[model samples]
Target: MDHRLSPAATARFILLLAIVLFLGGCRFLPWRSSPAPRPGHGLQDGKTAGHGEEPRIVFEEPDLPQPAGEVATPARKRACGSPPPPGRRLPQVAIIIDDMGYHRRIGGQLLNLDMELTFSFLPGAPFTPELEEHAYQLGRDILVHLPMEAKDPKWDPGPGKLLLSYSPERLRTTVRKDLAAVPHAIGANNHMGSRFTEDRRAMRTVLGELKKRDFFFIDSYTTAASTGMEEAAALGMKTGRRNVFLDNVHSRDKICNQIGQLIALAEKRGWAIGIGHPNQATLEALTRCRKRLLRQVRVVGVHNLVR
Candidate 1:
């Protein structure tokens, strides 16, 4: 029956109305949108309840953030080895440590070694970003360990492997995305691209993209039939192919022996390139052969060896 509210009641009504309007306005404010989640640098278990003897973690396609603007340039100039002073005639060797991002502990050990080793990082591996930055800061030559389809269907080449099925445009965009995943990569080398590298057309498409970004390529030489070097030559891009695989046998003795072979080749040819993976045995072998490596040949960054 009351015609109007009491003073206290009217004041409360006005206060509530003001609060509602303030709350509603806050939603449309600039800071209201949350930033996207960034990819984590650690391995998370995607385990199922009952699996095999060991719980296997299946890697999924990484949802790395697509950069907003044009791809950022490398933070620092690419690291290169200084030329020998006045041609003393010491043989030059460039040793590249591949498969770096998956095993951080061993990778750290390998990086800490007092050597001018080059590191090639897998783009979407769990520890890729952190390890790659460390390598860059240490003045090491860095490369995107670009994955490409292996010949065998059973051997998955991990995520981001460029396949023959990809259109030329898709290959180009995929190369950009892979390079973006590993910042400060001055170049790229294949991971396990036995099949893709053999396809001259696919290699040409992928390499053209790399050339546009002023990046070099090194064929892993996974297949003897690979046309990587030839395709790169056609594009007139600076390129090289692996001459020696250091850890194929995964033994310290074998690796050191391979290092010796690499040194011998460099001595014979005046320059050579060798690729190794991040392994304890490889690290141990490198540590063991450090004195020999320095004495027998001049160890340089892969950039120096790439023509």
Candidate 2:
């Protein structure tokens, strides 16, 4: 049926329709809308507080030791050179050949040696990068042999040497430059630093720079009073000292004896790092006796011994 509403009733009807539309649109209004409750909120029916709570622990009786017959005993200690008592264990001995990159012949001779030798190259030397890359490629560790002022002025380590007179900034700059000159060098060791190494301030500066670069330091122990270790330790840098100088005497017999001394030290201390030059006697002795030396100890790299 066609029904017409009066003006007042039409106005009322329109107002009612508008109110319904407004209520329907309220779902999209942020203020009137309510977000769904998140999972694990105990709003869901049939869920209770602490529904997944773990059960209270109950104490148990203490475990008793097994019978002597069921327990395993450690093996007995065997005598030295007695096949290691069936398990392999050897003392670690690290050999480092310092003063490299000076003469190609000596450096090449050292490279030819079968034993794994760490080559410490002097920065700014003619063959520094060549020898460093050669050693690195041969599965040997490379070290930057940093020059420092020696106790005797007559002994010149090399150009751009860090001297005691230089300020800390100059010393750090020199060390950084030297390190950059040697390629593939993972660490650095002082070269003839009997005087400079003794200066705690200077050594600290050098070691601080090395530590910043995440490199290690090996003190050649040129002098008994060297402070490289002390400074390095203060900076939390990985460090090691030369336990034996293989070529201190630079004679076949003396070097052989020194090698023996190195083995003895390695045995006593569980590890030792020996530093030697590429002297004829040193290389000769090392080449001749490396096989025999391997039998007594495991010759490793300087980094292995340090870290």
Candidate 3:
């Protein structure tokens, strides 16, 4: 070490101090923890891969973070000024697409929608089982579309038709077969049973079996005089009916109009179920109007709508 400081020694010491100060002031290195990985929507609960096909990447939307100290209320009650009745809550809409499985392309399109729409498959349809599996894996409700006696003989209820003339034993066997064909069918609805659905004896047989199996019934309302719902209630079975048909006209614009009607009905009542077919127009209408429908009321699965 030098006893006396020289100009060169002093200058070197100053340079070393300046270098240390500069590094400290830079602050470029991160000293905080890493941010939490934002999970994708629909799989926030970590139950996707094991379930249905990864919810067909419809709208790759991320869940919006809720504000602090805030909780979500049911959409139906959000606009309520006064507290609803003890048993009453928000308005909900459950849309069911009937006549699936017959047309593979349209049925697949309906299944891809992540809205949890119910799919009703016609028994004996070529691809009923395959479509049923798809609906089940995706966590959507499935219903076996049972055919019954129609008013006109020319209407033709196709194969597996449940005729009114069949004995009680035959009717029970036929109903069982229809329910078994679908993988996860929780209920059954008539495809076309104007004459049969009105027959009290016939409906009792069908409803009795459904009660044992713990299934529900949805009155398609093919005819105004049908007694399916009343019979199911007598048997202590869960049941509901279609409030509207979205595609009786088979036009996109018409279907959208029908959806508007459904929303209006849902708002008036606590809940409503709209039945549609698996057609191009119906799918297009649903895809376009979902944003608006979801805003006004909660669009739920059919099972949720059952009374």
Q: Please report the candidate that would top lDDT against the real structure.
A: 1
TM-score top scorer = 1
Q: On a 0 to 100 scale, what is the lDDT of residue 260 in model 3?
A: 71
lDDT of 1 by residue, 116-173 (tens): 9999997767778889999999999999989888676554566676888999998898
Residue 300's lDDT in candidate 3 = 83
* Residue 254 lDDT (model 1): 76
Against the reference, the lDDT scores of all candidates come to 0.76, 0.72, 0.73
* Local error of candidate 1 at residue 187 (angstroms): 0.8
Query: In model 1, which range of ten residues has the least summed lDDT?
Result: 70-79
Q: Show pairs that collide, candidate 3.
A: none
Ranking by TM-score: 1, 2, 3
**Candidate 3 lDDT by residue in tens digits, 1-307:** 7598789999999999999998998787765564432332222222223333332211111121222222222344333224335665557888888766566667888899868688888787666778889999998888888878777655555557799899999999998887877858899888778789999999999889888878899988777678998888888889988777777776987787777777767766677788888767988998887666666667788878777
Give stretches of model 3 more than 4 Å off: 1-90
Cand. 3 Cα-lDDT: 0.73
For residue 115, give model 1's deviation from the true position in Å: 0.3
